[model samples]
Target: MANQPQDDRTSKQQAIDDWLPITSSRNAKWWYSAFHNVTAMVGAGVLSLPYAMAELGWGPGIAILILSWVITLYTLWQMVEMHEMVPGKRFDRYHELGQYAFGEKLGLWIVVPQQLIVEVGVNIVYMVTGGKSLKKFHDTVCPSCTPIRSTYFIIIFASVHFVLSHLPNFNSISGVSLAAAVMSLSYSTIAWAASLRKGVKPDVDYSYKATTNTGVVFDFFSGLGEVAFAYAGHNVVLEIQATIPSTPDNPSKGPMWKGVVVAYIIVALCYFPVAIVGYYIFGNSVDDNILITLEKPTWLIAMANVFVVIHVIGSYQIFAMPVFDMLETFLVKKLHFRPSFFLRFVTRTTYVAFTMVVGICVPFFGSLLGFFGGFAFAPTTYFLPCIMWLAIHKPKRFSLSWIINWICIFLGVLLMILSPIGGLRSIIVSATKFGFFS
Candidate 1:
């Protein structure tokens, strides 16, 4: 061992030292990691793509979707590259990268909030989506029963979510991740098939309308935000990467990138067909949730809704595990608390409860999706990655790489500003018809 080259020894040392407690016994094959990435990227947000397609015409919508996918893939790769920048250190969390890129304060202030919004915000969406689907399913099955509000269903789902959230870490829930990925595909198929059924049916009025009510400007921003949200899995990229096995000869990220590419390809396959077909069928009439627009053959639609609810229930945890890990670490280190089972249960339960309340209170589905996607996903997925790459790599100023990074930064900033405005406007407009908590 002592006779080995310095470079080889350092590589081996880095591989061994990089093994985190959270990552212990959790190493996954490339395909399994790919499955996780697919599950993480494809969530309840995909249901809204048709609505987004409607806002931006199919031509522009498809263009944006493809563009978003390419940009997101690049940014994800950039993030991985950033992880490898510091030779002997590993960044297993999003904020860790942020702290390295800028400073601790900025990471705490900016990156921490981004992670919370991505994780907690998505959980809130899951509650809202699962609750709505459960209500719809129940109402379909028991027409004569008393009409139960979505809020009640949300509480019921949260009870289950609280239990699931207690899973110790991300890798502990690999089974859930696999099941969620399957569920996502099942529902996506049902949705696509339903869209075809709706399109071909007689007496169904549908035509492709690019923009309505909202002007071109508003619709463009709204559509952009929705697309951004649909691909906002960048927040969990590092956590997933950490689970891949590392070897001295061939490190973890080699397989991790393979998984990412494979996963994203599947994501594109699932996403594009649904968006195009749903828009073709419903056109401007497509509901924010394409599934909601699906009604006939009540059993199938109901089954698909059930699948969505199941998928989100699992997905809520995939995103939340990192946040939970971060919070527990903070409490244990800064607050001098023990890493006790009791503390874990209390924190996880409380976090789930908080998301449940917010999900129930703010039932603005499309608006919330847009808000998070635009305001949060744009920066986290696109803007920050470019900035971090430039900061770490120190690409020559005014070079092509530098210019591209600047352009990405501008686009992210543009989305951050415009997306929130559009999302808020949608919420306000939506509120006129259905008041808060309705």
Candidate 2:
């Protein structure tokens, strides 16, 4: 028989119970998460790979391309598992998923570093890249204008970050995110148009120069970690999922999934062309900021400069918030005297100021992507999620392929650790191999 119309009620109730929104005044406008994801992912575009393409040629660059896709797809698979288990539940951090599946200790350990890299490491890179981009624009367009002092740029960048960070909540930020997207997209398009005009033929055979034999396997592992960090927008999923309204009938129920999909699509499109073109033009001579490949109209370069600078403010705000919040909650909560909101604001302001100064002071800070990719990327993106999935799903209870899965997990962890070390070494040793600027 048609059997009492089955039990749709249970699933419906589950969805409703799971729906949680991000606690911000801008509740009505919740799509900011998507914008942030897109921006964060694309932020990597400004870095040194274009030059790697110049060095390695298109074939190896294409290898890097494939590697990036594999890593992103694997992370995405883990995220899908995360969504299914929790459904609409809002998780404050990536490790929250781990906590749900495993326990608090493991979850915290895994997520803490992940959050730092995303918020702190990535943000620092953004600021540095933004600074470099602005400097280029200034030199090109306003050659006679006095070069921007680092202090002046830092103050301007930090002030903008403070103002934006204080906005009513994420909803307002989401709107700004859209504007950022348009600006970034326009910059990419213009840059592409200019790049195409150069009329460089793609080189099929870019010689493989293994600067150091770190072992092929180790190099691949290092490459894997770099790729994983490059594509990690996964934390957004946990938070966004938690923010979503869990109503059974609501089709757009999982905003995290929706946001990620939207963001990845935009990021992939924006990055691929730039990487491909940059490789073609520079032929192993590409700089970290791919725009350096373009000798374009002053207007285009100026627009790029302004947008990168503005985007840095939003990035730094996101980077510093959790750090400040964690400090206050863990330390200040027990302390007798609490600072007022304005005072707290000042505290955070001071902390960011310090980071800006330190970030600018260090010559090697720009290599953050490689550094964190080795140290933090694996545990968060691959190993932790796999562990969490096993914990949450309890695969043994369900008669799943435990042996194979665990093996994969171990290998993932090993590779994650190995990858960044190799990459970091490569960056440093590249100098020695080629003999002090070979």
Candidate 3:
């Protein structure tokens, strides 16, 4: 009879999770994993690759691009493998996995804040990305049309989310995510192909654009952050895996890894051509956004911008679903609010509005990428999984696994420290030049 209360609590908690956005479904297919990862990873950050390469220069730029691909794939693999590590216990969320690796309270403290930063930050950036792209598309298609303020475009973008944010779970958004994946690939192809056809600029300068040593050093730092931002999938890897069903014979990891491999390949296809070909074509003079740099092909660039809008629409939801889960979980579980359509509607709408407002207020695309990328993306996407692997498995000292994990840790930490400095400086400078909502 005494156990009845505990059992009641357990049942109630399970019911709450089932009602929540992320944990409500677990029947997603391998293909669902593929596109969701694609949507989540190949986002606004990809649009900025040539810009990043411009800041990085040739050798270091190419090297960093390749290295980020390898390291993030490694970290993503670790996340997929660890999703069901504790036998029947599956980590349905990033924070849940953190709780397992670091214990209940400490795990929440360490992981939740960083995970929130990555997810929320992505949503905010995607708002600006979606809005700005829409504005670009309008301008490209109708140069004579009255120019719309970016703030209004941003508002139009957020209006879509206000409705879509009510999607109950990851499974519900699969179609959107699939379309998003297609659009991402489509736009990325357009970006690089167009850049290639444009050919190298007349007297293209490959030299670093910075006039001073300090400027060059800081640009290098900001470039690291930009690259870090491109590989932002690790933040959502576990959650993406959570949607897939698992069994002893057919573990989720098998299919999740397959999907991830496909997704990473797509990521490479999208990232490399845009970063390399676009940089090769434009060099240090590349616009922070490659699409902006390609102006001659009006119809094609306009279409690419539309594709960008559609892709980020899906990408925004991919990232926002987790934030919805977090907020709903907190409200229902901690505050004793009853879970219902009203609660969810209010919660999700509020979140979408919040991101939209912030995005409109500070639409500093390049600087936002660098700041959030280094401050949050590096730790979560680059090294946190390695830290978790070591903590959980305790691999033997000085072994290959041990050595590699430590190397990733060292690099990730360095990235975390340096990238923000440059990003912040850029934001400050941009703020001085561009007034709020200007």
Best by TM-score: 3
lDDT of 3 by residue, 1-438 (tens): 322222233888889978988888999999999999999999878988998898999999999999989999998998998888876578889988888889999999999999888888888888988899999988999999999999999999999999898889999999999999999999999999998898888989999989999999999998988899888888888889989988776889999999999999999999999999988999888888899999978999999999999999999999988888888888998999999999998888889989999988888754666776787899999899999999998999999999999999999999999999989878876776766675
lDDT of each: 0.79, 0.56, 0.89
Q: What local lDDT score does residue 436 receive in model 1, on the 0 to 100 scale?
A: 69
Instruction: Residues 341-406, candidate 1: write the lDDT tens digits.
Output: 788889888888888888888887547667666778889997898988887789999999899889
- Which structure is stronger by lDDT: 2 or 3? 3
lDDT of 1: 0.79
Q: How far is candidate 2 from the true structure (C-alpha RMSD, Å)?
A: 6.7
Clashes of 1: 0
Candidate 3: stretches off by over 4 Å: 1-9
TM-score of candidate 3 relative to the true fold:
0.96
Model 1 RMSD vs true structure: 3.7
Score candidate 2 by lDDT: 0.56
Q: Which candidate is the best by lDDT?
A: 3
